[model samples]
Target chain A: MKFLAEYRDPELAKQYLQEIKNTVTQPWSIMEVCGGQTHSLVKNGIIDMLPKEVTMIHGPGCPVCVTPLHLIDKAIHLALQENVILCSFGDMLRVPGSSKNLLEAKAEGGDVRILYSPLEAVQIAEANPSKEVVFFAVGFETTAPANALSVINAYRKGLKNYSILASHVLVPPAIECVMEDVDSHIDGFLAAGHVCTIMGNFEYYPLVEKYKVPIVVTGFEPLDVLQGILMVVRQLEAHKAEVENQYARIVKEEGNLEAQKMIFEVFEITDRLWRGMEIIPMSGYQVKEKYADFDATKKFKIEIEEAEENPECIAGEIMKGIKKPIECPEFGKKCKPTNPLGAPMVSSEGACAAYFHYSGLVEEY
Target chain B: MASKTKPVKMQLQCPMPKLDFDVITLGHGSGGVLTNKLLDSGVFDLLSNEVLDERHDGAFIEMNGKLAFSTDSFLVSPIFFPGGNIGELAVNGTVNDLAMCGAIPKYLSLSFIIEEGLKMTEFWEILTSIKFACEKAGVQVVTGDTKVVEKGKGDKIFINTSGIGTIHPKANINKNNIKIGDKIIVSGNIASHGMAIMSVREGLEFDSEIISDTTNLNTTIINLIEQFGANIHLLTDPTRGGVATVLKEIAMATEIGIDIFQKYLPIETQVDSACELLGLDPLYVANEGLFISFVEASIADDYLKYLQSDANGANAKLIGSVVNEHPKQVIMESAIGGKRVVSMLPGEQLPRIC
Candidate 1:
């Protein structure tokens, strides 16, 4: 609580809000490049407190939101197998696949477990020698090292029953995709602080240089987010497109090298399919050939034909900051958390879910 | 929720008595020698009172005034947790439900559906706690039944407690009674019980030890009714769906608006940290030992001060108030002066990938 309480201090947040109000001379659209940041902004009501000149755009930073549909079908298929035990993060259980979600499969008697760490899945494989354990490894760079380490831990223990169905994504490629969009009006970005804590601020420098947009590494706390927005506004006002770290306490320029090494050791960059979005080249991580024995897709010889997203869901547009969740035709009516039209509504960190959960009914209340 | 009490491991007052079997078997449910032996040895005597000692098929008791009856089944995995176990939880759950109805809990009927392989020692621990909890609430467990399921058919143990209580004479608790400008007062901290369970849950263990806040609130509720009377418009506990869901449900039902302040919401530092670590909202997390009261604005301060003096109400705070501005909506103003809707929980709050 030491570092956390201070970051949530209301007085400090007020100072940063005033600073942003004074720094901005004209209207600016700034996107926070993480679903966590978007969640904080909405949950803490920071979006309303910000000066009218600033508009916060949500990004496609939720791994659960962007995990391809076909992969979910495969994970479900694997879960239902006779000797397979599927383990996944709790959020992944609700995202609908082509037919049903993981929770539905579990209700139908599939042996599925919700675990907080991938290493626990490895331990499960160790405990049950006969049952095949497949971990639904999912997340961005913040989770890449841990997912990779699970495989490393499994291999060291010679766990023949352990494998990972990975859907790891990178933040930089997603940022570039947003910039390449013809209709995108994002002027600055508050990069994900936790992601930056792992991979560092070096990755954002090139994005700033290429798009001439100021990128501020932002923390998820209320005060940290407010400060991050102020920093971005200051850079935009001075016409300085550079990478700045507002969460300097946790993130460094080079990042955790050991974690980066662990990630590259077990995984390789691949052309991954993002849900509702087009395939971004070299944007996702796949298990390496050396870890092929620990890859569920390769081990089980499972093949899933490409599935399609719901035609009505504007998740692709929403992820690119082209449209808001409320702009979609079936936001709260047809697409609800109980019956989701897309992964964005199912995941807690999804832009659609965040907006649906935190944004009030009356706009001015 | 604030940490007014630490998790204390309860000690069994009486040791497990000698039994024919070390572990329960299917024969224990057959109502034969095994069943009688299991109960006669320790269960009946430990919870013995005039009503329970009668050994009748059902309890025959006398009631005077308007009564409240409530029943709840407990099926929490990890039957035992840091501060308490399923035994006390079952007792407190039904007791608090009756308390929320502005009733003084009096009699309880207990039942257990236990797995065949459950150890005798564990069952004794559970039964002992139930006896202690019943005594503390001044309620008697009159009649009961026990059934044993096959090993895989059930969890280690499941308890169901049904209670009947006499309504307080001065109480006027109803959702319709809530009026605009009514102040919302939270009894104590939030999210402690849920986090305590999560701390010991498989694969989600954290370094810090959080105790569950699972205690009876009948005494506090009865005292409030005795003092404030009808000024306390409504009384309800924020149990399963947490504070946010309960308030939202009330607002929607009564067609009244609620505005809560984040700064005033009472939560312990450790519980807040755990919620943040899991990417979970404490508002949606479950609480067992807390209640929300709707009182007239004039007596809100005095009510809070008086309630805060009680053991279970020390961490109590006036969180929000009823309004006519936005009917059917619950909005919370953040510590930083921003606002968002405190909506009903869509589903169980799940941990995030990050």
Candidate 2:
């Protein structure tokens, strides 16, 4: 409550909104590169309140929205197998795979459990010695430290039955890939605050310098988002492109050194494919060879076949900011939260789900 | 030929009760001595009244002309929660349902479907809670039934309550009466019941204990109807789907638009933090004791003041008002001046990694 109440203060938010309105001079498009920020913006109605000159484009910060279809299929395959207990975050339970989602598998008598943390999965493995326990590890850099520590803790305890289905993604490379697109009209960015809290703002300076884009590390609160937009607007108006910190209370320049070290010890950068988006170079982390025994893909001998996205879903274009969720013909009619045709419609932080859940405009579209 | 082997039995982990038979069995429902003992000593003794004491097949009672009849089943997991248990929930739930219909609940019929392996002490405890709740709500359990199933067939215990109440002649509380200018009033804090269950079920430890806001709303509702007759258009308890779902239901049912201001919504600090930590939205979290009222805008302030005078409605506030635009939709104006639709929850609220 200490941090939450102050950030949600209406008077303070009004001040930031006024500041953002006064700072903007011309039309500029900014992207919030975290699903949490996108959700806060939509839920709080900050998107509609912004100055008309500024456009807030949603980004690919939602890890659940970007997890490949094959990985979900593999997780479902492992979950339904005999003597295997599949532990995952609650968000992954409803995400549809190629054939079936994890919830369907669970209904069909799969031993699937929703865990708040990966460490709880390790504890489950310790308790059920006879059953193979696999944690569906997926998320951005903010989650890497915890997932990495789970493997480290398992190895330290010499737990043989524990492994993780790693789908860890990095934020910087994805930003770079977005910046490389010639059709993208992004002018600035609002970096995810929690990810910066873990990995620091050091990785973002290079992107800011190379792309000449102002990046403000922002928190997930109404006032924090308003202040973040104001900062980006000020930088854009002054023709300055630099990395600034709006969430200075939580994030630091160098990040958590110990967490970075632990992450390096457990995982290595590799080529990874985002669900609807094209494969970005060195955009994901794989369990290092030394921790191969803790890798679930190897431990379970999962053979993943190449899968294609639904031809009707425009989630790829939506993720790149080229199209909005409302622009898709099947948005609310065919693709909805209950029967999601794409990951964005299912994940809570996804742009499509955020728009569908919060904006009345979706009905008109 | 191989010899047939007897199946091994599983050892129950809980300590047995201090009774002749530690665990409940099918004999408890056989209408023999065990059934008589269970009724006379266990349930009837705790919840006794003149009608139930007559030992008749059904309760024969006199009621006023117009009556409201409603029934509900309680299948909440972990029958016991932080602030209350399923027994109190069952009573309050049915009582609130009747209250929502502008009726004063008077009599209730209680029934239970218990598992064979359940402990007698646990069953007694639940019965005691039901008695306490009925006494507080000024209702009597006039008739009831009990059945037992095999251990694997049921959970520990499940309760069903059917309530009958008298509706005030002047009260016309129905969704069809809602108009464009009607204002919406929420009773108190939201999302405590669902979060309390989640905290216990998921082993989520917070700095302070989050208890369920499970209490009877009949008295408060009756007071509102008595004071402001015909002005209150609709009364709905936001139970399963929280405030957002109830608002959507009203908007769609009446073909009216609802616009609620987020800043006026009352949510506890701890509930907000817990929801944030779990990636949950407080708007969609369930509340056991909260209800939303659609009243004429001219008298909405007076109604809010009247409600605020009551103990249960201390935190009552006017959250939103009906609108002509966006018919059949609910919109929320954010504190930062943004606007978005507050849609009904698609499924069970799950924690996200966003």
Report the C-alpha lDDT of model 2 over B1-354, residue by residue, as the tens digit: 011111112232233334676677888878899988778664776788999988799999999779999999998766777788888999999999999999999999999998898877667667778888999999999999989887767777899999999997768998888998899999999899988877766423344478899999999998899899999999999999888888987887778899999889998888888888888889889999999999999999999999999988999999999999999889888766678888887788888865
In model 1, which residue pairs have backbone atoms overlapping below 3 Å?
B1-B189, B1-B190, B1-B266, B1-B267, B1-B268
Q: Per-candidate DockQ versus the true complex?
A: 0.52, 0.45
Q: Which ten residues in a row have the lowest lDDT in candidate 1 chain A?
A: A356-365
Segments of candidate 2 deviating more than 4 angstroms? A303-305, A362-365, B1-18, B26-37, B54-58, B203-207
Worst 10 contiguous positions by lDDT, candidate 2 chain B: B1-10
Task: Tell me the docking grade of candidate 1.
Answer: medium
- Candidate 1, residues B1-354: lDDT per residue as tens digits? 001122335566568887778899998998999999988988899999898899988888999999999999999767888889899999999999999999999999999999898988788888988988988988899989999999878888999999999999999899999999999999999999999988877767776767889999999999999999999999999889899889988988888999999999999999999998887889988899899999999999999999999999999999999998988899999877889898866677888887
Please identify model 1 stretches exceeding 4 Å from their true place.
A362-365, B1-11
Residue A198, model 2, lDDT: 88
Highest-scoring model, TM-score: 1
